[model samples]
Target: MKYYLLALWMWSGIHLANAQQAAVKVLTRAQENRILVRWGVDQPLEWQRANNSGFILKRITIKRNDQLLASPEKKQLVRLPIKPEPVESWMNLVQQDHYAAIIAQAIYGESFEVEDTGEQSEVSRIVNMVDEMHQRHSFGLFAADMSFQGSIKAGWGYIDTEVVKGEEYIYQVAVANDASIASGAGIAGLNDFEPLPEVVDFMALPDDRKVMFSWGIIPYKGIYSSYMIERATDGRNFTAISKTPIVDINDKTGNASTAMYFADTLSNNDQKYQYRIYGISAFGERGAISKPISTQGVASVSTPPRIHDYEFKTDGSVLLFWEYPKDAEAEIQSFEVAVAAKDQGDYKIVGKQLTVSKREFSYSKLEASNYFKVYAVGENNQKIASQSVLVQPIDSVPPAIPQGFKGQIDSLGVVQLSWKANAESDLLGYRIIRGQDKDEDFIELYDKAYPQTHFTDTLSLKLSNKKVYYRIAAEDFRHNISDFSEVLIIDKPDVIPPSAPVFSNYELANSAVQLEWINSTSDDLNLTVIKRRKKEDVNWETIASFTDLTTVFWDRKVEKNQVYEYLVMARDEANLWSNPNNSQITIAVFDWSAVEVIKDLQALVDREKRVISLFWRSVAKGETIAKIEIYKNKKGEAPTLWKVIHAGQNALNDVDLDINTEYQYYFVPTLHSNTPAKAISLTVQY
Candidate 1:
């Protein structure tokens, strides 16, 4: 008896499958809290699977590009901890405390919770993505004398369908709406299924005033080869919607279905709408409605903003901000900010929901992606469109290059360089540097770092006289840099004359004054400038220019109590000026006085240490010099110099052999131009 009862219960449940759908009641939004839900618990019990294949609770989804949502979308896949159920798989790590914003694909990082994990509510794990594979069905519709337009999938195999070429199938349609929300006569499939009936069943329609509608068709065998379909409204009074006779399924030579379907792309959005399918049989019969579907109509609310403001702030952090959109009617929850590289691909969403005021957002941690744009949404709800905002961020540009750079060779074989002006904002002066030979390091020969780019390069005995190369680059006030221009090379000479001499001190005697200078190390060096100023004057006056000096020279006759000043310049065979050297003096009224002159000069001796051949020059070589002296500042000792030479001559190398200690020398040039004295050719090593 118990077995019989169980079998009867199972059969009853199978027969009541469609009735299970009626258990859930659809209610109007106005009466949502008091929804009328019915349960058939005593009739059938839900069987629980011992495995992991049940239900779960989750968050709602939001979609973009479509105003209507189709249940749940992936963006709303919630995360919550649960003990695994199949239907609740979408909920995994998200907990009840986790709050997230709901958004569409367009807005970037927006998400919502899927569900909470508790007793009965569990997060299901995915076993496989492609666990279910459905074989492709072959079918298409053909018009059996305008009866039915058939099938669903691809067109193929038709060898076994025992239908005739002229057999007909009936199609039908109906429309309905919510009784409380719309409050009108709900519609349903009008005409009953008949064997090619001649007229539509108008009385079966619920009413004419309604919002939603539905449609479908039924199949039936026929003998004629022709049929015509008629369409109607409110599932009533007949009227044909199509002008031509659609194909039939029974007469199809290839794969085909005798059923037909119709989709509505166009409808009045202001008012709710519903669509129904219709089919005509060769004998004028119609099928019952399949299902009723409603359109998701929408209304346009606002126009996009006319202008957008993109502000860039250079604080410790670089911030990108924008203004609110204009002409927005509805409150917006977020905006999508896009960024693109300066010279690269399209702008993509970098951030979103920066704010909720329909606009105004900021971004930081910026690097190379400089170009940017913004867009606005009307509570996008992930459906409608996003308005746009446009603005440029870059302000002042970089400084331009210097106007002109020209170089010319002088009679002394030195490069004379000059450049024009840079009129842009706060461009400090420029510096001139030179690279001699091809592989030598560039050196600066200017007195100051920010000197104008104009310079005169006198060949130095210390540097090779090959091609001298140079170029110029600019640095703006903001330290923005311009690259270097092409290089310019100029040729130099091989040799130069001796430079102007210098005297450390001078004094006046009863009728004579003496002068001396620290010597040099160059082999072919000569020439000097003598400067003098008589009394209180700010201007420095040159007394005379003396050339072809041997070493130090002395002047015998002079007036009493005369004060004077003198400076010198050195030169080589090429007549290039080295650097300036100077001297200062005060003479007594009438008295013979010895002048301390030479202080520091150079002396290089050969290995043999014989025949001291000294090389040095003086500022006032011809002036009266009671004596000349050379000195060196050693570590932890008083300065030492060559002995006082009252003979008025620079120190020559000596072979006196003092290898016990290291020694460096300073020489004074006791120079004379007219004296054919073989010029003391001595190589001093002491």
Candidate 2:
């Protein structure tokens, strides 16, 4: 009796808990031959308000007789199908309904009507009598629950239930947790319906008088059947042009196939026509029309367009205007503009193609020399361009200022100015301007402009001690002169003294000295002065003065063994003197005695031939002795009858001497008026 009472108490407690209702929402809509059921899983079920795990939406199809069906089979059951996000955690909740578990049962072939609840807001949890159909005999009975033990956050969920069109569906939502199940949250239902799909991507192209039209067919729920092509001349109120529907051979099947196309031979030239397409459903319902595509229905012409006038505006742009050829045989479609650098050069299209109605165009960033023309295009193409208009763009921008200007004075007092040249192609020449004082006005030095990079100004003697300032300017053919170059100020043209002359060759004799030097290389050298001083003297004396061209000097007033020092200097026309650092000194000496005698001597004789041969050597390395003497002596007789020989002949033969009688000979090498040198003797017989 104790166990029985305990069981009775537990049953009472479960009964008391049945009054708690679940807070859920359910909605069902028709799609093709199926029903899509959606629900909210935001609130907890009343049975376990704080401990719910997951939710279940049940769909029921009722029969027309208002009879409630019992225990439907599993094959007759449906599930809520929904696609999930890319995250793996949401896959079970948002996956396709085809893979969804059969969480609800429904009767096949049931027909019913669904009514809207007058209550707009969702139904709140309510207390109700417990339905005994749901039972939890053991903990294992929780196997069919969602197994999602976590709390239900606010989110939406959906499922697709298969059903017949024109049939009604009744859907009910329920939820379960680890402990128990709850039902009767809300109700909603609807019948299945369908409409035609829309047509898209319609296009039209003209080729050889035949207009080809094409479109891509879009289907609603993969049920598009065919398409119809239409045309409108006035761009509105289109009518079908094809006799039969352009069928989609793939028909209602969701697979890629060739797009539908229709070609119509143009009937009238010179007309503008628009075309569109419509998609039809399998039920023969027509859908919305596609966007229109227009084209010109005209034959091709080969004539070129004509240009009227063109000019360069002050804003650095070229404005061009042209007209369609009046004599064109075909309808004008567009006008093309082309430009070239020269009259006979290759041309390139300027900008975008223009409609025949447009007669004016502007081009920017043009070159100084440009030729432009227009080509009138028929429906087909152009054969030749119109006559070109030559344009010489005027230049108003000045050249960059010249830099690196410099000025200097030469020995001649001529001011030379130079500067870097400006690189403008239109540059004519350069001008040299000068100012005598810093605050004075600069005046052009030459009447004509200088074509070279440098100029010279010959200064007058009267302009001595005047500080001259110079600047340069570049001019163009149109006199678009650049600003003045950097000022080159040449202070008073003080004559730069000539470079000092150097002594090249000199000679000194008894009381006489001769000097020679190269002339000064200075262009304005006036003259040269020679100064001299004796070694015993304390001061220098001006010995001579010569003109600028003189290069030699002679002095005769000099004492023997006297050391003399001399310096040469150069003077320019301005009375400025060159440096005298280059000086030379020499001593006067004279030789009064004869030169030394030749040293080596020898002689040879031939008696049978009555001739003597003599040979001698000289120690004088480069100096030549005056002569050599040969003396002959018969045996036992003093040597006499001396004969003279030139110094170069070192050997002589004494012939015709006493033959068979011995004779002696001797030789002496001599210098100018010198005593006889040491002798060598030889005795010989014929």
Candidate 3:
């Protein structure tokens, strides 16, 4: 009988184990100091099908230190009222103590189902369509009203209880079927999860002798909490400035409708201030602070001084002067100077901060990009800046006055000046100056500064037999002129003279010697003088004088068989004489003797042959015969007309004389130049 009873009890325990919901989760509400319990079954449809009945909840508590309090014996059970809708807020419990443990239970039927309406209703069809669209199983309107009998399912649940401040508590929970069969118990202590709300919209505004701050309040959701304000000189790195948190009413109004205000007293008015506010919970938990805000105390601000004049040198030096307003509001403590290469480039400080009383500044040996600006600082530490100044260094020192100055004049009276180039990096140009005399003041040779070291004075064309002095000076890019260079004296050249006349040809006549010569080629020649001397004479006599262009000369006084020497000299307009250096031409004048009469002369004619022949002997001294003339005429006509036919020949033959006609021929011999010889006429018949 005992074995039978044990078997029956084991079967019932197995049945209860097969029909149970998941264990419940318990949470403590930090916003309300209340306990909230929630539980759900993993297979609600299967549980309803098996039990066909609703769940029952059970809760109980045990206080370890409060033994005088009546401890609940047999867990207090409460039947969950059947409702048409499923419950999300399974349970809510309030407890007086700030500390306690909670336990809970849920019992439900193993099988149950909602009664189905046995008709095709529009509401049912709509509900089914909605379920399909959502991809979820349809739950009947009366599904929560279903209950279970005999307790087919069982599972643990939870009840939240507030815990005493700084105290600890433990709790246990279990669930049983309608047959009183129980599951394992769950245990936990009260836990708080809610955190304090963050303070919103914290700000700092500048005010005289103080910095005012305001922030949005977070309505007390749990216990009464307060706000703590913090401050920092820099934007970051803050410390609590308000020793106590500013309190607010814990009423139901939202923090959005209210804002908390505070002022951090200032020891001085010259520094920047940053602020933030934090929400402190009643439990001493501090939420995150609001985002930081910064401000500067009120003070008069002024515009920076203006730079009125500035200069830059090629040697990397800068000079600057400025002017500032003298009004009382423009009071300035100091001035700051900075330089940069470009508009947006990082600027480096020029030097130590300067007093406002000093209106001028200078810098030297700066060798980078040159943009600059100055800032005026007020007593409140606020700064205003001036317009940027571009520092472009200019070359000031004139070049080492162009060394090695020299001038030259050409044969055409052109003056040329040359000198060494200036070594200055910024030398702009050179100037050439000229003076008529070495000691006189020089005038500019050119209308403008000469761009090169060499200068040709085109306007100094009258530089004949006169001295001209020249000097050079240099100017820099900034028009800094240098002193004149060493003097360069150039004397007009007199090197050119009339060219010597060349003897081209000579001819001797009876009473005179004819001479022809090439004219002197010098353009400046003034006159030509012809001189003559006999071989026996010791001195030369002037034969003729002619102008500079004359080329020919005549010497009418001459004797035969005499050797005479002749030469020509030329003079220029400068009174310079041509040096012959013994250059001269000599010639001998002579007369040729007359030729003698012809000897052994004969003439013959052949009528049938139509030929005629003549013969004669030449003069014994052939050198004395310059030429012979032969003349021919009709036998009777030529004797009167007497034309010469042949000369200097010993024989002559004439042919084709008219048939049966007689011809006469005259032969004459002439001396070299003096006279012709007697003529002989010959008659021939053919």
Candidate 4:
């Protein structure tokens, strides 16, 4: 009887509460995203009013339609609606005004509307949920006169009822600890039969990279069980990287399918792999899984040492050196060395087979004038060579190059000729000759000269157009001449850019507008990101700019529905904005849900100097009292922008004053918007 009465009270509250308020409203309004009953009130009722102060609205109650959904304290269900606001967030809420208001929600959520449930085994909890969703902000605990139990079948001492519902086992047993619960004034925690699973192979490594598993445990009896693999990249996200369990031992010995595996790669670059197993009896009972076993992967080097030096000594022996004071891979043997001089000189042999593991090397008698080099070789044979060091010995002179003489002359445009210089002082630089006409006898192109390398011509200038041609020759000094280089040419292109893109007018919605356009041309090399800003908008605006070659765009926000102007363009890698695609479109700007509340909807407000009045309305069934929050500030105290009016009661909506006085206001209906309860926000502005 106690439970029955409570159920009835809750039911009545749902059907009668909101219906009473719906009868008083006079205005019909729709917000851009909300539905309104009338000119939405802006001023929250003064909290001192009878409804908000000393008086408390009577707790509304309703009758339950069925025996289900009659629990008194369902913590889980209630916790859902009571969002877990952080302590600071909750404190901030209460501290905002004198106190925070608790707004009500729709009467039990809409009754369950579901498809047919065939005789097949299926549980229907929808009906139960709908009836229980009312005042969803809180959950209850007491199970009704009937057993509001979970799916578990038979228990240690519970008895089953008749008329079985498919696989569902209807069991009910009197509370053995009713006395214990009454004394504590709390519900009893569930107590079931014994034997939870036992840990078989439990083990954890010193590092946090630990794996948990169970094998050979009581609950797990080799009928082919399951396991998990957890890994951490930074040693923080210990994510379960495996979907299947590890297969360490086969149930059927040789017949066991290949076991899937898991390696938890840890931050230290070490991988700890664990294996565990579980099983279920043919009759449906389950055994504990065996404990887990862990193994680690081989250690590895994440970095290497820095080499800083290398030098050489005299005596034909090349010295090899390095700087790896901390290198653990030091058991290095045999030092290999090679030498070369000048950019064009071929590399020569110089290093000894071994350097007795010395950091410095000593080299002796050989071509003392040549450059020398030293490189270190690792056990793995990997090597690092030092920069070649050019050395001058006590006895050396410039190698010889046949000097004087040369050949040919021509004037493709200017002239052509040849010559030579000393072969080797470590032979470098070249010389070219030029003549006005064939065999005209020439002069050196460079007044200066060297050995080898000769010819040059004006063939390019004689070609006309934008093309310029020329040719080069190789020189080896000492009067040695090689073949000339291939002829060369360069040119400049002549092309132009295309026209600008064309865009459509702005389409309004919410606080933004939509804009679209056409690509500039066939070679629309790049689709520049779209840009926008309000008319007279100072800075360049960009709602969404994409670099990908996209021709279509939708600029989300334009200044409300007001007129906004925009230009569009395209550019190539050359960063050339195409001609501007211009458009001046005007859109309507209004908060639809912002109800234009008449000072006195139908009543009168008369004063000697002006008139101002209050309007009233009623709420509907299931509709909630959003905020009647009121706000007021002196003109100099606030910006022209919308400012929230805070100090007021939750139900207070209307405010009346002298019409000549400047005042701004609006109301926020509980309904954020007309879209849907869970959709768009509806604000009832006055």
Better of 1 and 4 by lDDT: 1
Query: Model 3: per-residue lDDT, tens digit, 1-686?
Result: 00000000001001122345533222222334433332223233433331233344444444434442365433434445222122222232102210000111112112212122533234334433442212111121111111111011112223344344322233322323422323232332233445555656677766556777776653543332456788888777888874334544222122333666777778777887777777754333467767777776765455677888887656567888877776733566788888876668888888546876777788885533467777787765667778887775644556677887887778777877788888775567887787888777789866766789888885344334256778889876567789988788776766656567778888765557888888777777778888889877888788888874667666778876789999878887777777776447899876433346676678776667777778888654534565666767885563433334344456666774777676777766666555435555566666
Model 1 RMSD in angstroms:
30.0
Residue 383, candidate 2: alpha-carbon lDDT: 41
In model 2, what lDDT does residue 231 have?
82
Consecutive 10-residue window with the lowest summed lDDT within model 4 = 142-151
Tens digit of lDDT per residue, candidate 1, span 1-686?
00000000011111122333212111110011211110111111121110012112122223223333455342111232112222132123122101101101101122211222231122111111111110000000111112111100000000112222222211111011211111111111112112333212211122112222222223333322222333333445444333333333323333444443322332444443333334433321343332332333333324333334455676533444445534353544455667655435576777766554544556664542345565554432332233333333343454566557778776476678877766754454565566765477777655443536677777654464545787665554445445555677776554444433557655543465566665443555555555555555567665555565544445554445555445555656556666653334543434334333344345565656443345554334445544455444333345566455655464465554444344444443332332111111122234
Clash counts for all predictions: 84, 27, 29, 86
Give lDDT tens digits, candidate 4, residues 1-686: 00111121111101222232211111111112221111111111211021111111111111123223344321121111111223234333333311121111111123212222331112223223443432221111001101111101101011122111111111111112222111101111112123335444544332233332223332343232334444443444454554322333333233343333333434542554554434422112234644444455433222232334434444445443444444544544455656665434776656556553445545564353455555555443445555566664443333333344333323334333443544344444554443334334445555544434455445444222333333334343333344443333323121234446667544545454566666566253555656655565676565555466565556555434355556666665445566563522334444432332212222233555344343444333343434343344333345232323332232233344434455443433333333112111112222
Instruction: Specify the poorest-scoring 10-residue window by lDDT in model 1.
Output: 1-10
TM-score of each predicted structure versus truth:
0.23, 0.25, 0.30, 0.21
lDDT of each: 0.37, 0.56, 0.55, 0.35
Q: Can you write out model 2's per-residue Cα lDDT over 541-622, one digit (the tens) per residue?
A: 8998888477888888766556787778888776888887764555444442333444444445554466756555666644
lDDT of 2 at 587: 48
Rank by TM-score (best first)? 3, 2, 1, 4
Task: Give the TM-score comparing model 2 with the true structure, all chains together.
Answer: 0.25
Alpha carbon lDDT of residue 654, candidate 4? 30
Model number with the top lDDT: 2
Per-candidate RMSD vs. true structure?
A: 30.0, 26.0, 30.1, 44.7
Supply candidate 1's per-residue lDDT for 63. 29
Poorly placed runs, candidate 2 (over 4 Å): 1-301, 311-319, 329-332, 340-348, 362-368, 378-383, 393-400, 403-686
Q: Any idea what lDDT model 1 has?
A: 0.37
